[model samples]
Target chain A: MAEAVAGCVRHGLPAIGLWRQNVAEQGLDETVRLVKDAGLRVSSLCRGGFLTAPDFEADNRRAIDEAAALEAACLVMVVGGLPGVVPGEPLGEISRDLPAARERVAEALALLAPYAAERGVRLALEPLHPVYCADRAVLSTLGQALDLAAPYAPETVGVVIDTFHVWWDPQVFEQIGRAGREGRIASYQVCDFLSPLPDVLLGRGMMGDGVIDFGPLTGAVAAAGYAGDVEVEIFNADVWAADPDEVVATMKNRFERLVVTRV
Target chain B: MAEAVAGCVRHGLPAIGLWRQNVAEQGLDETVRLVKDAGLRVSSLCRGGFLTAPDFEADNRRAIDEAAALEAACLVMVVGGLPGVVPGEPLGEISRDLPAARERVAEALALLAPYAAERGVRLALEPLHPVYCADRAVLSTLGQALDLAAPYAPETVGVVIDTFHVWWDPQVFEQIGRAGREGRIASYQVCDFLSPLPDVLLGRGMMGDGVIDFGPLTGAVAAAGYAGDVEVEIFNADVWAADPDEVVATMKNRFERLVVTRV
Candidate 1:
């Protein structure tokens, strides 16, 4: 977490999205102090979900406490998949009961939203791509995410639009407009999609290397009234293995050459 | 080419899609005879584009000939990307001129449609996912494919809706309905997306294993007036490496358990 923050700070990045595991590893208080001392904005915490668990109360409260300690702008929730885990295997498979899981997630969000708002931290529902529908998030589209956030005030709960996940969406522009009208646009993450990928989880392209037309995408978001800083969140192993400074330099260069040119 | 066809035949699979290189390897005359002997249908000839070439005439003409000889029901066009080859590398890179490439593909399709119709072969405009918008089919949506095919008679040119590509599309049902209403639903291929996949190309799942609600999708296509056979096309390396008989058995089981139940 500190390495990622230091890289961003060196690269002159304005904000950083910290993952919960990282915060936990460093101790939340110390992590917050480090970020604060570095004068970096916590764009949002990486996540706080899995509310579909049978034991929701304990998990949800702990998540709230962590988000509060981080002083996160938003807690980006990657609502968990199925109920249980098999021995020796990771718990990343979806249960057959999607509608029920969605309902549980919504109920948990409803419970947490007020608490989050009172603490001055927005709870952002990050709708993952449909590919992640089985194991990560049931909310797969921008419309669905916005719909989930519909009952809550924008300041309480909103949606995050990650271009890697949502760029393939035909209704992206219209949904961005809808999100804007509803004031649900929370954060926008940009990345490209190159084919014949090596790792589904980590092979995301740098900003301008793939096929997403970012200019029109950002334009649509801006037209929808979003004026937030564009976040470059790539999960590429290739990028991660490089010197962190080089990675940030490449990200910054791609941001200017590819993304900025398009915008 | 022979291996694919033999597998299809041995498996009692009704149809198989073949790439041009595969066809070339077996020689067209023997390949046609082999397919006929197996009583298998040629669902689609793998591809017929790369139309962005300065001289589209040669590639286009050869593709038409192959499709005609193979007696393919549809010539699935993976319209090419950029022009020019960087020596020693496959001519597979993002095209600098996307608009021009799109136009070239449209022009080539327009020119080939008549010949395809004359040969009783349908030209299936495959709208690839936007991930391939740089170096593959410029047609990135069913709506866009339909728009491209609008000028031609449905009998001459139609659209191929591959579930692997279009399953995530929010407007899928809308565009599918439109295709059905216009009598342009040419071919429908079924596959599933497995998240955290090992390889994007070969990791497509068997029907029920992934996130796709194929029941609703198949029903929508039937409602759209499509009466064609649902081709169970999986590109999994594990499945391919397994005994072909087992692959067939698994596919058949999935069809009966999932697809048949839905339809």
Candidate 2:
């Protein structure tokens, strides 16, 4: 965690998106202090939405607190997939399918929304790709996530525009426009989509490494009036194996070429 | 092919979905005669898409003729994904991506729709799961397929409702209802969707084994007025390696309890 923060500073990056596990490893208070003292901003906290967990409210409360401590823009939420071992739910013995899981997410969000708002921490619902609907997240599109956040205040409930996941969606650009109009574009994540992937979860390619034509996508988002930190979140094995400095350099280059210049 | 047809006869199964390759290997004439002699019906021919191929028109014409020769119900179409490596076309030199591939599919369908209409072979557009949108079929939803089939007569161009492929779609039930109202349902294929899929293509599970709650999905199709052979197309390695008799038995058993009885 320290290495990452120092590396960001060294690379002249604006902010750091910290995962909860990494934050917990370094102790929340110390991590918060370290990031703040170094003048780094938390773009967005990694996550907090496995609503299938038995103690979802309790867990998410802590996640909100952590995001608050780090002063994150919003706590990104990956709503749990089918009624099963939700990422945050160790005691998750849920029996719901897609529709049921979706209902549960609304219920879970209702329970957390007020709390997040009270803490001045926004809840950013992220829609993973439909491929992960069976196991990773029931939320599979930006429109659906926006619908889920409809009843709440835009500041209290927002939607993430993760290019890796939403790049394939036909409704994405329109939804981004809606999010921007509604003041719900919490975070914009960039990553390319690759296929013939051996393991689906780890298949996210670096920006510009795969088939995604990010220029139009970014242009659409920009047209929607979104001016926010765009985080590069690649999960490929090859990308992770490269030197941190190299990966950072490549990401910035791709971000400029594929997104900044076009948008 | 003969063994499968004979087995279907012994088991009192009315029809067998035939793959074109299998028919070609057994000699089209002999295979057609064998099924006809055994009083077995061809539910639907496995495919005839890859529209990006250079010789797509000629190839599809042959497929249409083959389906007519076998008296198959429809020619199930797996519209080719991104342009390159389409089935024919000399290892395929096409460079079109998703949108281009989709446009090519419509163009190819426009050309073949007349040919198919003249021959009495319905073209069944099977929208593969979105996960396959980049590599297998650009048509990733029943709605998309229906839209593509909009300009044609329902009898000439119809959409397939494959439970395994579309079970996760948020718009699925509504789309199935639409297809039925439009009388555009060409085939009803069933297989369960399993996640953490080792091989994306081979991840389709036998009906009841996966997380998919097939009851509602099948019910919607049935409620939409589809009364056709529900072909079970599983590409799982284990199921493929299992004894044919066992595989058939399991599929029938699951189909009854998880689908027939429920829907």
Candidate 3:
């Protein structure tokens, strides 16, 4: 975590999105101190949703507290896949009730919204690609995320516009517009969608390395007036095998050439 | 093809969906004769869309003629994916224009609808699961398929409601309702969604063998007033490797217990 903070400073990047596990491992206070010492901003905390768990409220409250301490932009919420997906096992339809699972998310949000608002931490609902609808997130489109965020105050709950997830959606641009109008464009993450998905969960490629046309999407975000930090997330195995510095360097280059110019 | 027809007769099944390739290999006339001899109805022809291909028109017309010759209910259209995905090569974003690919489908449908209509054949637009949005069919939802079908006569352009594909959709029941209202439910195909999707293309499991709650969906189709042949399509490797007769028997057993009762 220290190295990661230093690496961002070293690479001349402004912010970083920290995963909860890493923050737990690094100790929250030390992570905050390191970021503060490096004069770096925390773009957002990695995740804190999995609302399906029995202990969701306590863990999520802890995540909110951690995000508050870090002064993170928002808490990225990957609101769980289905009711009972055991890790390291084949995904089963323990319950094939998707609507009920989604309702659970809405109810969780209602409870968490005010708590997050009190901490001044925005809960960013990350709508994963529909491909992950069965195993990662029931929120599969920007439109669905916005609908879930509708009843809550925009400051209390927002949405993450990840290119890899929403690029395939037909209503993406319109939803981005709605997100902006509603003041809920919490974060804009960039990555390319690869094919013959190497790994369903971690098949994202660096921008320009896959099939996404960044110009229209980036321009749309810009048009929607999302003047926020653009985080890059590539979860490919080959990219993971490369040196961290090189990966960061390539991300910056691709963002500049394929992403930034659009805006 | 002969065995499939014979098996259907032996199993006391009334109808079967025919793939164009299998029909050609067995000689189209012979296929028609075999089905006729066995008193088996050709519920629908396998496919004819791939609208992105340069030869889509000629081929689709041929498929239309084939469907007509067999007196099939419809020509199933697995509208092609992105424009330039080579068969054995990695799926590249040779073009990241999904909207454009979809537009191509609309255009192809405009031209072919009249042709299909004259032949007394319905072009059944099958909205493949969104996972195949990039590599199989640009039409990713029943709503989208319905929208595309809206511009034509219901008989000329209808939609296939495949449980394996549309089961994950939040708007599925509503769309099925709309399909009924629009008189566009041309076919109802069934299969189960398994995970760790064995192979993206062939991961479909036998009904009741996976997570699909067939009762609600089958009930919805039945409620939509679709009194058509319920086609069983299990593409799993294990099921495919099993004895064909045994496979048919199991499919019938599962369908009776898990699917038929729902309706």
Report per-candidate DockQ.
Answer: 0.21, 0.40, 0.54
Docking quality tier of model 3: medium
Which pairs clash in the backbone of model 1?
A: A215-A262, B50-B80
Which stretch of 10 consecutive residues in model 1 chain B shows the poorest summed lDDT? Answer: B82-91
TM-score between candidate 2 chain A and the true chain A: 0.95
Report, for all candidates in order, the number of backbone clashes: 2, 0, 0
**Pairs clashing within candidate 3:** none
Backbone clashes counted, model 3: 0
- Candidate achieving higher TM-score, 1 or 3: 3
Q: What is the C-alpha lDDT profile of model 2 across B1-263, one tens digit per residue?
A: 87888889887899999999999999999998999899988999988988766677788899999999999999999887776643212223334345666788899899999999999999999998877766678788788899999999999999889887887778888999999999999898888776556567887888766767777877888888888888888888999788989888888888888877442
True contacts kept of 1: 0.16
Alpha-carbon error at B88 in model 3, in Å?
A: 4.8
The residue pairs in collision within model 2 are none
DockQ score for candidate 3: 0.54
lDDT tens readout by residue for model 3, B1-263: 98889889988999999999999999999999999999988999999988987788998889999999999999999998788854336965467788898899999899999999999999999999877777778898899999999999998899999999988777889999999999999999999987556666777899866667788888999899899999998778898788989999888888888898542
Model 1 regions lying over 4 Å from their true place? A1-12, A51-61, A80-114, A194-196, A208-213, A261-263, B1-16, B37-39, B51-57, B80-93, B96-108, B129-135, B138-144, B171-175, B208-213
RMSD of each: 4.2, 2.6, 1.6
True-contact fraction per candidate equals 0.16, 0.26, 0.36
Worst window of 10 by summed lDDT in candidate 2 chain A: A85-94
